[model samples]
Target: MKKLINDVEKVVLDSLTGVQAAHPELRVDLENRIVFRGGTPRQGKVGVISGGGSGHEPLHGGYVGTGMLDAAIAGEVFTSPTPDQILEATRGVDAGAGVLHIVKNYTGDVMNFEMAAELAAVETGVRVEAVIVDDDVAVQDSLYTAGRRGVGLTVLLEKIVGAAAEEGLDLDAVTALAKEVNARGRSMGMALTSCTVPAAGQPTFELGEDEMELGIGIHGEPGRKRVPLASAAAVAKDLVEPILADLDFTSGPAIVMVNGMGGTPQLELYILYSEVAKLLKDAGVTVARNLVGNYITSLEMAGASVTILRADEEMLRLWDAPVNTPGLRWGA
Candidate 1:
């Protein structure tokens, strides 16, 4: 409720003004609220784009840049972008090689992106494909999604697939790789506190001081169950166990992420990662690459999520590719 803002309805618009000022490398469309990679329509390269509600910063928007997303559409807080907005992004980025839509498994996102794809094909004749990331091992259905709600693995998917597209892979190849990445990843999260939407001006949910919600969604949806607050090591077990049970990560190298839900400190994240790394090691899951930070987050929510991707050599190589984006960058 005590957020720094002029008006509730203008949060997205106002913050986008800052994004435009800060990251000139990204072209921000104030009218449509779409952030496109600067000098876009990179001909012959498969265009990669993703979108969802706001609040999850550095996600669909913060990722637009070299070796990542070509465009990212932003909606109101926790609200899906309309089909018209999505179609505009698709049209703006396509340069003959086609476009890939990386969508979370939320119901609104899925439907709207689907509509946009169809519209792009019919109206602009731009080839469009989509990959739905439903890697959350926490629940099969949530308040916003029919299947498992996509969580932290989305960041991994965008980076890997964007690298593939940057490498000049065709639309079909990029889409296939994206699907493969989604298939290999699994995620689980826990929340210590709930987030407040700017418009609502109050916390989305309440949690007792001595309690934590395990297997929480990014949008403050109810988790698997609430339990007594536990130690970092115990919390790591609560997250890693379901993911390991869902897939066999021991077969090969894995890419792991310990992501903050927004309000958790970097100090606490590292402590949690220490415990997570040990658990993966004990489980014989070799972590070849790792990210520990606030990559995807709910608005000022006190929590963290774990994402594990069972990776192959190609995935590792692409993951190491140069990326220049606000959210993630290295080797650029």
Candidate 2:
């Protein structure tokens, strides 16, 4: 209710305008809401395309730059882009090398992206492959619902896979790298409170002043449970334990990211990271590379998400590649 904006319906349009204007190296397709890599799609190199909702700023669009995504499609706030939009972007970015769609594991997102791929196969010879990230350990792979929500690990996937694409790896190679990251990564999120979607115009869920929701989804889906607020160390344990249990991060070195859920501050993120470091050390996992910030988030949801990636030599090499984007920059 307190959000600063003209209209809830125009949030995506308004935000994209500013992003395109600020970054001259990027080209925006307003009608389609796809962000291209500021030039014609290069031939003989694999095209990387990613997208989801709008509130996760500097995500799909922000990462569309050199050594990153070739194009990014934007959906309505917390909603999936239409299949037609995704198909257009897929066709638009095709340069004979094929295109990869990096999609999160949300219901609408998965369904829409799948439909788009089907359309692409029927209409064009542009080969499309997707690597679905279900790294969030929050949701159990149950028989009823979508298994898990892709969360913070998605940010890492984009960087490493993008680097592989920049290295001129074939579509299969890049997708393999993307899958490797997804398989090795595990994430868990905790929410201090729920966020209100502009369209809904109300809080998605409620948490008491002294309670927090654990295992929350980015769009404010109810988490596994809400518990009384606990100490930073206790909360960090809540976030990290599920991830550690979900993956074998202890057997080798790992890359760790402590991500804020939009409303949390850097200071709190670091405080949580401190406890995460201690816990990982105790678990016999080595933190090789670490990022502590808001890489992925729910809108103004006060909390954090922890992601751990088991690293290998090849992944480490790609992780070091230069990347220029609004959210992350490295090696340059």
Candidate with the greatest TM-score versus the true structure = 1
User: Which residue pairs in candidate 2 have backbone atoms (N, alpha carbon, C) closer than 3 angstroms, thus clashing?
Assistant: none
Residue lDDT tens for model 1, 89-208: 999999999999999999999999999999999999999999999999999998899999999999999999999999999999999999999999999999999999998989999999
Against the hidden true structure, what lDDT does model 1 obtain? 0.96
Evaluate all candidate structures by whole-model CA lDDT and list the values in order. Answer: 0.96, 0.87
Lowest lDDT 10-residue stretch of candidate 1: 246-255
Q: Per-residue CA lDDT of candidate 2, range 1-332, in tens?
A: 88987899898888888888998888898889988887748878899998998788767888887788988999998888999999989988889999999999987888988999999989997899999998878886532238887888898899989989988999999998899899999888889988888999998888889999888878777777889999999998898888887787547778899998789999999999999999999999998899998788778889888889998978878888899887888776
Which residues of candidate 2, in runs, are more than 4 Å off? 141-145
**Highest lDDT scorer:** 1
What clash count does candidate 1 reach?
Answer: 0
Model 2 CA RMSD to the hidden true structure, in angstroms = 1.5
Clashing pairs in 1: none
Q: 193 in model 1: Cα distance from truth in Å?
A: 0.3
